[model samples]
Target: MNNKEIVAQAVYEVVEEQLTLAEVERLLENPKSVDHGDVAFPAFSLAKVFRKAPQQIAAELAEKINPDAFEKIEVVGPYLNFFMKKEVISSMVLKEIAKEDQSFGDSNIGNEGNVTIDMSSPNIAKPISMGHLRSTVIGNSISLILSKIGYNPIKINHLGDWGTQFGKLIVAYKKWGSEEKVKAEPINELLRLYVEFHERAEEEPELNDEARAWFKKLEDNDEEALSLWKWFRSESLKEFNKIYGMLEIDFDSFNGEAFYNDKMDEVVTLLEEKHLLQTNEGAEIVDLEKYGLNPALIKKSDGATLYITRDLAAALYRKREYNFVKSLYVVGNEQSGHFKQLKAVIKELGFDWSDEMVHVPFGLITKDGKKLSTRKGKIVLLEEVLNEAKDSALAQIEAKNPDLPNKEEIANQVGVGAVVFHDLKNDRLNNFDFSLEEVVRFEGETGPYVQYTHARAMTVLGKADFTVDPEAVYALNDADSWEIIKLLQSYPEVVIQAAEQYEPSVIAKHSIKLAQAFNKYYAHTKILVDDEQRDARLALVHAVTVILKEDLRLLGVHAPNRM
Candidate 1:
């Protein structure tokens, strides 16, 4: 156990005489103010159980129980205040940091377990927008956090390379597209064709029927339709890869909805044999009204399968292939009803493991108080946003740190990190207004600020000539030093919490808290004092550097050493 847990266990020994260990652990709280003591236990709850006044209970307990882990224990107005040995806590924390280094927050709780996460399912023939950013980074960070805790996380891009969209793209391409322009700029040219088709279809309603017919032909494996569909998929991936490269993201599987085409037949047969499939208005559906959900449509009257059918096939295929302990679908909140129907249908198919499937939904991204829509071409391209951030970071670097080496590399890290960190710092379920200017700012709770703090810690460590001695005990009793130590000590718990809650914002917020504490300590305390003091302070700085770097890594943000 760490120092905090050790102290809590000691308190548990005394408190268990009247209450359980779980209750004692739950009651322990870190005091917000230094004068209040290191840890406080409110005796008010125990007064009701013991049939005595809270102050009397606290006073009696403080006088009777004395723990060696605490330097002093006293009663103050119905509360038991416990003071820690600052020197002991500091020495232990420094030694633990020195021992563990980058693996400080890792655990083995998820050993031998597996998780399959489906995210970044951007549609084909269109550029990725700021709207897809949440699923990409949030899913990526959750995977990283799971791996840190010893789970084998399977990352799937789950590309949206299926359905009637491709048919529309083909129709648009035949009417307005040129081979030369498409080859030169596939996504933009295709997007232009798509937008044009929608505009013209408003007048020429026959285009809608034509598009649906083309999709049916494609599903029937028509050679001409397949060729066009394959070309669109290939070109779209090229654009997607460029964006993925800029974000430093990779996926284990690109098995999109198209991959389940042949597999859907077996799933439908199983549903039919199990009596789960019902015909309603010539469409195949699973009746879920008994379970309080809308009927799940499996196949259209024209024999074309739906998204939920493909998902059902994909889920069963995943269970057979990976036997995953949990499968997470990182989709938007708009699809909550779709997932509800999906899980219900899976359960109806007699797969009790359907409970393991999770729908990790996030809110929408807006621009000028309007939802982003590619149909209207009113969306911001992710590439442009990334480039603008890079340009802003480059300008800042040129103005502030002109002599900094590898300026371009540092600019890339800071710039991309700014956009990504800004998205991650907020709760995923909360709608955020996307603004390039607000996110790229180097001050406040921005990514550049944390990166700069990390660089500052690195600078202090780099100037020190001697290495930290793990066994060397030091008295770091100042309020700032103690605060830094306390925050550093909580890094492991923060990492665990991020993984458990599937929220990368926990680590993002913790990084800002640690950075703020370190900056406050840096302004007042000098790292380079006498030889021994310098070494001890270097140890602290090194620990901060290690943690800040790892925390940012888990959030999928780069921490440059010389930003």
Candidate 2:
């Protein structure tokens, strides 16, 4: 068992003799400091039952608690805190760090259960805007955390490869799109045609009718419509692959809305079998008024399937295929109502596991307190953001270290990491004011700062010609050393909390804190010395190197040893 689990078990044993395990768990809270002990229990929670003062109850428990594995017990106000032996904790941290390295903070808490994550469902033939950034990065990080905790995470890119948008594109393509232009710049050319079609539709209302007719033909499986749609899908995927390559994100499945075209009939059949479908104004919908949701439109009056219909089919198909313990939809908070209705309809259709579905909602990204909009062409392109950050980081590298090798490669790592780290440092539920100037700044709690700290530790390790001896018993009594050790010891807890809350920001914040602590310690202490203290200090430095590198890897940031 891990230290926290072990400590919890000890606390459980003490409370089990007097109270229920559930009650004990309620009493146990995270301690403010390691010195206040590994875990703490508040007597105030039990004061009414015991009919005694909180301090008296805490003192009584401290006196009754037997010292077996715990080092000591202390009573502070109404709190009873237990401290583990320092040597035991230090040794545990060191041994685990050495044994796992990159996998140090991981645990089998997920127990091999399956979790299906749907994210990055950017529309085909459209450039991925900064609007999709939150869903992509946040979903990827949640998947990484789940996998680290032993969950079989399935990453799905529900690409927007279907809908009337394709019809509009097809109509515009036949009218004005050039094959050569599309071949050379698939996304840009298609997007241009799409914009022009909408702009022209303002003057020519018949264009909308024509587009709808083309979509109907596509739905009827017309040969020309099918062929052109296939070409658009293939070309759009090629462009998406380039962006995915740059971000280093991969999906286990790309079964998008198009994949559910034939399966929607089955979903409708199931809904009918369960008597949950109702016709409203000639359009099929599920009456969700009783569930406190607006009626979810399943089919339009013209018999065209909506996004909700495709999603219903997709959800059922995933369950049949993966039998996931949880299915997470990592979409924006605006879609919360959509998911609420979706889950309600699934449950009404008698799918018991529908309860496992979750909407991992996040707020929109804005600039100057205004929401980004693609229709108005008032949004930042994701590629532009990445490129700007890279260029800015490259300039910083040239100014800071003129002799740095592979400047371009290091720039890519630092720049991309900065964008990601900045997005993740805040609460996922809160909207962020995104600014290039703020995200790329290398000073204070940024990705570049953390990377520099890792690089510095590498430099220290290279300067010291010392080897780590696992058998050596290093004394860690110095204040600086203890501070570093305490941070290292808390790594697993940080991972657990991040996983439980489905928040990558927690891990991102913890990594920056560790890097900052290490930098402070390095500036104050000397690692390479001419005495036995050198070996112990070198070992500590090595430990820091191991952790910072691992933490950066978890954040998907590259730590160049020579940066």
Candidate 3:
């Protein structure tokens, strides 16, 4: 068992004598000092029931508790703090580090069932903008966390390869786009035509009707329309694959909106059978007024399927196909209402498992507190961010380590890793003011710093020949050693917490903390030569290197042995 679980269990044993384990867990508090205790249980909440002062109650419990595993118990005011034996904590830290390696932080808490994560769903024909980074990174990180624990994670990319937007693109391409221009630069040429079409659309409104007619023909599977649509999708996917490769992101499913076209009719029939579909004007909608929502439009007056219709059909299809334990939609917080209505409509159709559907909403990525929009052309390209980061990292390497081999390669890893780390080091609910300046600064609490720390530990290990054995005598009585050991011991807990919260930010923060602790320890103590104490310290450094490498890997960052 892990330290957190062990501590929690001990606390449970004490509280079970009085109240239920659930009640006791709710009343438990994190201890302020490891020196004072491993875990602290506050008696303040029980004061009213006991009819005694909290401090007095705590004192009584302290005396009554057997000092078997714990060294001592202290009652300070309403808090009962239990200090564990130093040797016990040190031994557990060494044993766990040696045994688990990369698996140290994993747990089986997610034994409930599989989790389906829908993320990184970039649109077709549009170049991936900086705005898409949040959903991609956040979703992938969450999937990593879930998989680390015992959850079966199914990653899906609900690519925007269908809709009225395609009609406009098709119209634009037919008018001004050329096959030669498309082959040369698919995304760029497609985007140019898309923009031009919208621009000319203002002067010639009839073009809109024409585009709609083409879309209708495409829906009816007209030979010409189908041929063009398939070609567009194939070319767009090819371009998208290049970017996904660079980012190291893959999806189990690329089921685009168009995949649900045939399924939508069945959904519409199901909704009609359930008497959930209503006609508003010439358009088809689901009257959600009773559910405290505005009418949800399923189909337009032109009989074209909308986003909601596709989403509804997709949801039903996924339920039948995967029978997923949980279906998570990693979307922006702005879409919370839409997801709520979608789930409500599904539930109304009698899908009992609809309750398991979750909308994991994240706040928007802003610049100077303003929302980013590609339509307004006020957006940064993700490729630009990556290039700038690499350039910045290369400059830093040239200044500090000019003699380092493969400098450009290392720079790419560090630079890209830094940007990814920064995005993940905060709660997903918090809006991020993305600043390239801040992301490239590798000085403090950053990915580069952690990578550098790992490299530093490797350097120390190279200077000495030492192997860490959990059976080796480890003393945490010294302040410096205790500090490092404490951080190492908390590694598993950090991973568990990150998995539980569905936030990779927790793992990112823990990596920085571990790196910071190691750096401080290295600066204070010498770890490589002729002394017994140095040999022990070298062993500690080796253990830390293993941990640093594993933690960075979890965050999808490369941990270069020499940085």
Candidate 4:
């Protein structure tokens, strides 16, 4: 059992069945100041039972409570503070890590239920930009975090492969006349025509009308439009896959907006049967005034299906396919209202499963303090940024460890991991500016700092010739070791907390804290001396390596054994 459970059980014994063990555990809190103790319990709740002031009750309770698990119990005002035996906790935590290794903090809380994550979706004819990084890394990390806790997370890249955008691109391509250029560089050529189409549309409104006409033709499966759309989608996926390979991410589903084309009719039919469809300004919508949301537009006045219509169809499809316990959409904060409308419309259809859908909204990644926009052709390409970061990492590795083996592999790990880590380190809803230099640096709460710390610990283990010894008594009571042991023990709880809140930043922040603590310990501790505690100290270092690796793994980062 963890220290908190041990303390709770001890208090449960002395309460004479007045409070259950679970109740006592719930009541326990960490002291604001470490000087108070490790765990604190306020006696105010028990004052009525003892008919005494909280201070007296705490004093009496302290006297009656067993002290085996604690170094001491002190009564301060109305609180009973517990300082656990550092040696005992250190031993338990170390042995547990040695035994569990990569499986230390894993749990089966999900009972193997499925969770659908819609994330990393980029449009068909555009390059994946820095703006898409937030959803990609955040969703990827959440998938890893959920899997660590036993949830089967199905990642879906809901590619924006359909709609008027494709029509606009086709219009631009035909008018600007580009078949050979597109063959040479698909995304760039397509994006160029796309941006030019928007620029021209501002002055010539008729271009938009032509774009709409072409989209209608594509929807009706006109041979030329279909061929062009398919060509564009195929080329885009090839480029997108190259980037996904670099990031070490994969998706279980690539069901984009087009996949639900035929399925949308079912959604509209269902809404009509339910009598939830309303006419608003020649458009078809679902009135959601009761849910305090705007009317959800299902179909445009032109008889074209809207985004909400396709989304409703996709929701129904996912339910029938995955039977997911929870469905998450890792979209941007700007689209929060869209999801609210989606869920409200689903509820209007009388599907109770609508309650299980969650919109995991996140803020944008900006450049020069401005949001990146694809429409204006103003954005940073994610692939270019990753390549630059990788090159930067390689240069640093050459300076620090020139002879390091597998230089390319390690540099890729460090570089790609740095970008992914930077995106995840921030709170999901907090917008932040991106800088390549700051992200890949070897110090200052960056991914490389944590990676370097892990590498440093591994170096210590190698020098000591350390190996897992389940038979050895690995224990340490030194202030530094105790702090790490406490953090290690709380890892299981940390994973649960991250899963509960759908937040990856929890794991990211915990990793930074642990790395900082380990660095401090390494500076002052004589861990390699010929002494009785040598093995235990090395064991602590080994434990740190295991956890730091696992922690990085959960955040979708890698921990290299060497810098």
Q: Model 4 segments beyond 4 Å from truth?
A: 202-204
Model 4 lDDT, residue 382, Cα = 95
| Model 4 Cα RMSD, 1 decimal | 1.4
**What lDDT score goes with residue 274 in model 4?**
97
Give one digit per residue, the lDDT tens place, for model 2 in 529-550: 6776776677777788877776
- Candidate with maximal lDDT: 4
| Count of clashes, each model | 0, 0, 0, 0
Error of 2 at 275 (Å): 1.7
Per residue, candidate 1 scores C-alpha lDDT tens digits across 1-563 of: 55546656776676776777777778888878778778888888888778999999888888766567677887888888888777778778888888888899899988858899999989889899998899999999999999999999999988989988788888988888888898899999988888888889899999999999999899889999999999989999999999999999999999998999899999899999999889999999899998898899999997878889899999999999999999999999999999999899889888999999999888888998889987676889999999999999999999989999999999999999999999999988889888888888888998999999999988887776656676776557678888888888888899899988888999999999989999999999987887556666778888889899998999898999887
Model 3 Cα lDDT, one tens digit per residue, 231-296:
888888898887676667788999988898899899889988999888889998898888898888
What would the per-residue lDDT of candidate 4 be over residues 40-88, giving only the tens digit for each residue? Answer: 9889889898889999999999999999889999999999999999988
lDDT of each: 0.88, 0.84, 0.81, 0.92
For TM-score, the strongest prediction is: 4
Best-to-worst ranking by lDDT:
4, 1, 2, 3
What's the TM-score of each model vs. the native? Answer: 0.96, 0.93, 0.93, 0.98
- The order of the candidates by TM-score, greatest first, is 4, 1, 3, 2
Give model 4's TM-score versus the native structure.
0.98
Overall local distance difference test of candidate 2: 0.84
Off by over 4 Å in 1: 2-4
